[model samples]
Target: MTRRLLLSHLSLMLLVLLVLEVPFGVFYARSELSRFTHTAQQGALTLAEVCEEKMEHGLSTDLPGLARAYGRRTGSRVSVVGTNGVVLADSAAQAQALVGRNVSAEPDIATALRDHPVAGTRSDASVGGDVLFVTVPGGSDDTVPCVVRTVYALGPLKAKVHATWIALAALGLGVLAAGALIGFALARSFTRPVRALERATAQLAEGRLTDPPTTDHGPPELRRLAASFTKTASRLQHLLQAQQAFASEVSHQLKTPLTALRLRLENFEPHLAPCAQDSLDQALGEVERLGRMVQGLLALARLENSAIRPESVDLGAVVADRAAIWAAFADEQRVGIVVADAATDVRVRAVPGALEQIIDNLLSNALRAAPPGTAITLATATAPGEGGRTPAMAELHVIDQGPGMSEAERHKAFDRFWRAPDTDHDGTGLGLPMVRQLARAADGEVTLEAAPGGGLDAVVRLQRADARTHRQRPGGSADADCAGNARPHGVMAARGHP
Candidate 1:
C-alpha cells in the first residue's frame, strides 16, 4: 500500500511539473531568440546611420569595406543598397550578383527605405537557410541614397534553445526523483504502525495476549492508533487473566464450604427426626446444584480459554450413548426417549464431551417445557455433501414434544444469559451459548427450530468422521441410551442429556 501511494504521489508531481515547465521552457527559449534578433536589428539601424555619414562625406567608396568588416565581426551578411532599392555593395557574397538586384520589392528593404529599421524574425527556404532578416534606412536623412541590411542564420539560436530544453527536462526529472523518495519514506513511516497493529492483533487472536507492540513512529495519527491498540490489548489481557484468577479462587472457596456442609449434613443425619431428614435432604440437593453450577462455570471458562480440539467418533454410537443416559430420566417424567439411527454406521469429527454436553443442555431445557408422557426423540442422520456427490455429513438432532420457541426467542436462544420469559425453571442461561461456541470450535454449527408436533428441535451438524472403524451392534450399553434423556425434579427438569 505504501509503495502504491508513493508511486501515485510521484506520478501526480511529474504531471504537474510537465504541465507548468514544458510550455514555459519553450516560451523562454523563444523569448531569448527574439531578444537576440531584436538586438541585431537595432545594431543594423545604428550601422546604417554610420554608413550614411561616411557616404555624405564622400566615402561611398568605403561602403564595401565597411560592410565586409561589420559582417565578418557579427556573423551576419551585410549589404548597402541605393535609394531606388538597388544594392550598392555586399559582404560575404559576390557584389555583382546583388548590386543590380531590385531590393525595393523586398518587404524589409521597402520598410527600411521609409527610414525605420524593419525588425522581426522569420524562417524561410532561402539559400542561406533559416535566416533572421534585419534591414535599416541609411542615416537620419530619408533622402540618403543607401540602406544597410543584416542577415543571420537561426541555426545557432535553435541549438541553444534545444540545449535549454534538455537542461530543464533534466532538472524536472531530478526534482521528481527527489519527491518520490521523500513520499516513499513518508508513506512507509505512516504504514509501519498499522502493519505492527495487524501483527499484534493476529498474535492476540492466537492467544499470545501478553506481548504488545512497541511502534511509535510516523504521524501523530499513527502514534495514537498504535497507543490505542496497545491499551486495548493490555486491558483485554488483564481482564482475561483476572477472570481466570476469579474462576480459580471461586472454585477453591466453594469447595471448602461445600465440604463443610456435607460434614454438617452427616452430623445432622445422626440426630435427625424424620422431618429434619427431609429438610437436610433438600438442603443437600441445593448444595449439589450449586456445586454443579460452579463446575459448569469453571468448565465454561476453560472452554473459553481454548476449545475446539476434535477427534473422530462414531455418530451412531454417540447418539446411542446419549439416548441411554436420558432414557431412565425421560421414563421417570413419564416421557418416552427414542434413539433413532442408533444401528446405522455414521461418524463425525468433533469434541465428544462438548457435543454430549450440548445435547444434554438442549434436552434438559426441552424436558422442563414439555408435557409429561410426551415422547422426546434423539436422532442422527447423514448430511448430503457438496454437489450431492461427496461423503455425507453427520447430523445429530434432539426433538422434544415440548412448548416451542417463538422466532424472536429462537434468535436470542444462543445468546449467553438469554432465557425465554415463559421459561419457569432454574437456569444459568449459559447452556445454549456454550453449545454454539463449542460447535463453532469444532467447525460445526447448531440450530434450533420448531418440532413437528409442538416443541423445540435442536440440531447439531458436524463433519463426518472416517468410516474405517465403524461397528454396528444390535444392542449397545444402557449407559449409551441414557445419554440423551432429561430427569424431572418437580417443576425444574435437569441432568446431562445426550
Candidate 2:
C-alpha cells in the first residue's frame, strides 16, 4: 500500500511538470531563434546602406575588403553581387574562389537584385547545413543596383536553443526529485498511521483489547478513527465479559437443582416397577446429557474468551494414554480401541489440556458411532508442512469403522448445534465446534475425512515441538517406548466431551 501511494504521487508530479514545461520549452526555443534572426537581418541592412554609399562615391573597388572586414568582425559570410547576375566580391577567403561567378540565382540575392529586401532562414545544401540569409539592394537611387547578402550559420543558434532546453530539463529534473522526496515523506506519514491501525485491529480480533492505539498520532481523521476503534474494542470487551459471566452464573445456579433431581430419581428407582424404572433411567440419562451440554457450553465460552499459552507435549504419549482410558468404555459397547504402539512419544506445542480435550471428544464421538465388533484406531505420526519439509507437524488420527458422513454433512458438522440428519446416538451437537475451537486456541487444526475402510477419520494437527528438548529412551526409539508408567491419568473426565 505504501509503494502504491508513492508511485501515484510521483506519477502525478511528473505529469504536472510535463504539462507546464513542454510548451514553455518550445516557446522559449522559438523566441531565441526569432531574436537571433532579427538581429542578423538588421546588421545586414546596415551593411547594405554603407555599401550603397561607398559605391556612389566610386569606392566599389574597396567593396571586397570592406565586406571581408565586416565578415571577420561578425563571423558571417558576406558577398557583393552585380545586378547582371555575377559575383562582384566575396568576404570569405575560401569563397573568393567563386568571385566573378554568376550567383544571382540565389533566392535572397535574386530578391535583393529586384530592389526588394529579403530576410529568412533555409537549409542550404551547398553549405551542407541550414543558414540564416538576409539580403538588401545596394547602390544609390538611379544607378544599377547590386546585392549585399549576409549569411549566418544556423548551427550556433540551434546550439544555444538546445543548451537552454538542457538547462530547463535539468531544472525540471531537480523539481521532480524534490517533489518525489516530499511526496514520499507525506505518503509515509499517511500510511504509518494506517499500518498501526491495521495491527491494532488484528490484535483486537485475536481477543487482545488491552493495548488500543494511542489515538494521538497521525492526521486528525485517523486520530478520530483510532479513538473510535478504542471505544468499539472497549464495548466489545465489556459485552463478551458480560456474556461469560451470565453463562457462568446460569450454569452454576442450575447445577444444584439438577443434582437434587438426580438424587431424587435415584431414591425412587428401587421402589418402582421394571417399566417405571426403565422410564426413570431414561429420564436420568436425559438429565445427565443436559448436564453435559451445559458444561460443554461453559467450556466453549471460556475457550472463546481466554487466550491459550502453548507448551511442548508428547503427542504419542497423550494419544496412548487417552486410548487406554477409553478402552473400558469401548469394551462395554463391544467396540475395540487400539493405540498404535509405534506412536509412543512424539511431541508438539499446544495449550495444556488442549490435546486431552480434543482426544476425549474425538474418541467419544467415534465410540458412539462405531458398531459392535468394529475397531477404533488412535495413531500419531508426522505430516509435511506446506512446503513438505521437516520439522513437520505432529498429527493425531482417530479412525473408526462407523457410518461416515457425506461431504456436505462433514462441512456443516463443525457448526454449533448441528447434527446429522439420521443418527442413532444422542449428542449435544457442540462436540465438533468445541473441538475446533480448542484446536485453534492451541494453534492447531482438526479436520474430518472419510476413512479408507468406510468410517470417519478425525485428524488433529499441531505444531511440532522443538526436537532439541526430546531425550531418546535407552535401548528404544523415543516414539516406540510405551511403558505403562508413561500413561497420563484422570483422562475419562477431560472437558469438551459430548
Candidate 3:
C-alpha cells in the first residue's frame, strides 16, 4: 500500500512536469535560436555599413582587419563581398587564399547582392558542423555596394539547450523523490492507526480487550472513529461479561434442584405400587431430560460467549481414537463400527478439542439412527483444492447405514435442536449448531449429505494444517501425541458425552 501511494504521487508529479515543463523547454530552445539568428543578421548588416564607409574613403585595405575584429567580438566568421560578389575581405585564418574566391555563385551572396537579407542554418564543411548564416546588403551610393555574411557555429547553442533539458530532468526527478517521501509519510500516518484498530478488533473477537485503539493519532476522521470504537467496545465488553455471568448463574441455580428432584423421585420407587412406580419413572425421566436441556442451553451460551482460537491437530489420529472409543457402544447395539482412512498422517486445523467432539456428536447421532444389522463408519480424507489456488481441506466423515434426511431436512439439520420427524431420542437440539460453531471457529464448516448407500453422511470440513505447523510449534509432534485432546467448543449435550 505504501508503495502504491508513493507511485501515485510520483505519477502525478511526472505528469504535471511533462505538461508544463516540456512545452516551456521547447519554446525556450526555439526562442533562443531565433534571438541568436536575429543578432547575427543585425551584426552582419552593421559590418556591411562599416565596410561601405571604409571602401568609399579608399581604405578597403583595412577591411580584412575589420572583419577579423568583428568575428572575434561575436564568435563568428565574417566575409565582406563587393557588388559583383567578389570576396574582398575574409575573417578566416586562410584569408589570403580566399581574397579572390566567391566571385558570386553562393546563394546567400547572390541573394544579398540583390539587396535582400538571407538568414538560415545549414551544415558547413569548413566549420565541421552546422552553422547559422546571415547575409544582409548594406552598401549605397555614398560608398560601394557590398554584402556582409556572418557564419556562427551552432555547437554552443545546442550544448546550452541540452544542458537546460538535463537540468529540467534533474528537477523533475527531485520533485518525484520529494513526493515519494511525503506520500510514504502520509501512508504510514493512515495505516498505523488502521493496523492498531485491526489488532483491537481481533482481540475483541477473542473476548479479550487487552489493547484498545488509541484515539490520539492519524487523521481527524480516524480519531473520531477510534473514540467511537472505544465507547462501543466498552459497551460490548460489559454486555459479554453480563451474559457470561447470567449463564453461570443459571447453571448454578438450576443444576442443584434438578439433581435433588430426580433423587427424591427415585427414592419413591420402592415405596409405591408397580403401576405408580411406572408413572414415577416417567417423571424422573422427564427431569433427566430437563437437566440435559439445561446443560445444552449452558453449552450454547458458553460457545456463544467464549474465546475461540483453532489449533493444529492430527486429523487421522483423532478419527482413529474416536472410532475406537465408540466401538464398544456400537457393539452393545449389535451394530458394527467401521473405521476407514484413519491411519494417514493427516494434519488439520481445529479447536483443541473440537475434532473429538465433532466426531463424538456425529457418531452419537449415527449410532442412534443405525439398526442392529447396520454399521457406522468413521473416515478421514483430503478434499482436493481448487487447482493450486487453494489449500486442500481435511474432511472427517461419519457415515451410518440408516434412513437419510432429504435435501430440505439436511439444510435445516444445522439449526438448534433440529431432529428428523421420525427420530425418537431425547435430544436438546443444540448438538449440530455447536458442531457448526466449532467448525467455523476452526475456519471450516459442517455439512450433511445423502450417503451413497442411503444413509446420512455427516461431514466436518476443516482446513489442512499449515505446512509449517511442526516448525512453528514448540513440540513438533504435539498434534500426534495429543490426538484425543481436540477441543470443539460447547457441542456436548448431557447425554452424548461420556
Candidate 4:
C-alpha cells in the first residue's frame, strides 16, 4: 500500500513537471535563438553604415583590411560583395581568392542586392561550419550598390541554448525529488493511524477488551472512527457478558426443578398402570433430554465467554486414551474402536479440557452413527508448518465408518440445534457447534470430510506445542503421559439428545 501511494504521487508529479517544463524549454530555446539572431542583424546593419561612408568614393582599396579588422573585433566573418555578384573583399578568407568571387547565389546576399536586408542560417564551406548570416545594402548609389554581410557561428548560440535546457532539467529533477519526499511523509502520516486501528481491531477480534486505542492522534476522520470503535467494542463486550451470565443462571435454575420432577416421576411410576408407567418413563426421558440440553447451553455459554489459557497436550496419547475409554461402548454396539500407533509424539497447544471435550463430542457422534461390525479409527499426525516459520501442527483425525453427510449437509453440521434429516440417533445439535467453538477458542479448527469407502472423517488441527514446553513436562510413561492424563471432569457426562 505504501509503495502504491508513493508511485501514484511520483507519477502525478512527473506529469505536472512534463506539462510545465517541456513547453517552457521550447520557448526558452526559441527566445535565445531570436535574441542572438537579432543581435547579429543589428551588428551587420551598423557595419554596413560604416562601410557606406568609406565606399562613397567607390569600392575602397583598403576595404579588405577594414573588413578584416571589423571581423576580428566582433568575432564574426565580414565580406563585401558588388551588385554584379563579385566578391569585393573578404575578412576570414584571402582577398586574392575572393576579390571577384560572385556571392550572389547566396540567399542573404541576393536579397541585400535587391535593396532588402536579410538574415538567415545555413551551412557555409568558407566558414567551415553552419553560420547565421545578415546581409544589408551598403553603397550610396543604388546602381553601384554593394552588400555588407556578417556571418556568426551557430555552434556557440546552440551551446548557450543547450546549457539553459540542462539547467532547467536539473531544476525540474530537484522539484520532483522534493515533491516525492513531501508526498512520502504525508502518506506515512495518513497510514500510521490506519496501522494503529488495524492492531486495535485484531486485539478486539481476539477477545481482548482492555486497552482500547486513544483517538488523540491522526486525521480527524480517523480519530472519530477510533473513538466510535472504542465505544462499540465496550458495548459489545458488556452485551456478551450479560448474555452469558443470563444463560448460565437460567440453565442452573432449570436443573433443580428438572431433577425434582424426575424423582417425582420415578416414585409415582410404581403406583400406576403399565401403560401409565410407560408414559411416566417417556416423560422422565424427555425431562432428562431437557436437562442435557440445559447443561449443553451452560457449557456453550461458558466456552464462549471464558478465555482459556493454552497448554501443551500430547495428541497421540490423548487419542489412545479416548479410544480405550470408548472401546467397551463400541463393542456393546457391535463396532470396534482402533487407535493408531504414532511414529513420533505429536503435541499441540490447547486449553485444558478443550481437547478432551472435542474428542468426546466427536466420539459420541461417531459411536451413535457407526454401523454394526464397522470400526472407528482415532489417529494423530503432524502437519507441516505453514511457510516453515510457524511450528508444525498436530492433527487429530477421528474416522467413523458411518453414514457420512453430503457436501451441503456438512456445511451446516456445525450450526447449533442442526441435525441430519432421517437419522435414527438422538442429538441436541450442539455437539458439533461446541466442538468447533472449543477448537477455535484454542486457536485451532475442526473440519468434516467424507472418508474413503464411505464414512465421515473429523479432523482437528491445532498449533504444535513448542519443544521447550514439551521438555518441561514429565515424559516416558505411556499411561500417565500427556495423552493418557485423567479426563476433564464432566467432559462427556451429559450426552447430547435432540
- Regarding TM-score, does 3 or 4 come out ahead? 3
Per-residue lDDT of candidate 3, residues 165-268 (tens digit):
99999998888888888888988888788888888887787776799999999999999998898889999999989998998899889999998999999888
Please tell me which model should have the higher lDDT, number 2 or number 3.
Answer: 3
Spell out the clash pairs found in candidate 3.
352-486, 352-487, 353-486, 353-487, 353-488, 354-486, 354-487, 354-488, 417-429
Q: Each candidate: what lDDT?
A: 0.72, 0.75, 0.78, 0.75
lDDT score at residue 274, model 3, on the 0-100 scale: 81
RMSD to true structure for each model, in Å:
10.3, 8.0, 5.1, 7.2
Give the worst 10-residue stretch by lDDT in candidate 4: 472-481
Model 1: residues with Cα > 4 Å off, grouped in runs? 1-31, 50-72, 77-81, 86-99, 103-105, 126-131, 175-205, 209-236, 248-296, 303-404, 424-428, 435-498
Q: Please give, for residues 1-498, the per-residue lDDT of candidate 2 as tens digits.
A: 788988898888888888888889899988987898788878877887787777778898989998999999988999988778788788888778898999878777777787888888888776789998888887556454678888888888788888888988898899888988888888888887788888778677666665678777879999999899889989988997898789779877989999999999999987999879779988998888778667667667766776545677888777767778778888998999988755455678766677777787788788878889999998787865555333467888889898888888888888877777775445778778876776666567889899996998898887777533222111100111111122322122211222
Task: Give the candidate number with the greatest lDDT.
Answer: 3
| Stretches of candidate 3 exceeding 4 Å from the true structure | 1-14, 54-61, 81-89, 94-114, 123-129, 139-145, 170-192, 383-391, 467-498
Clash count list over all predictions = 19, 0, 9, 3
- lDDT by residue (1-498, candidate 1, tens digit) is 798889889989989999999999979887987899878977887888888888789898898888899989999888899888888788966555776788799888888787767866677665445888888787665485688889888888888888888899899999998998899888898788777777788777655555566655767877877788889888887887788788778878988999898788878887888878888987887776666556556656766665234667777766666667777877777888887654387667666465666677766776666689788888877756666445456778888887677877878877656667765555656667667766665567788888886888888887676632232211111122222223322211232221
Candidate 4 lDDT tens digits, 211-299? 68779877999899989998999998888779877976786689789989999989997789987877887788778767766777677
| lDDT over C-alpha atoms for residue 346 of model 1 | 66
Q: How far is candidate 3 from the true structure (C-alpha RMSD, Å)?
A: 5.1
Who wins the TM-score comparison?
3
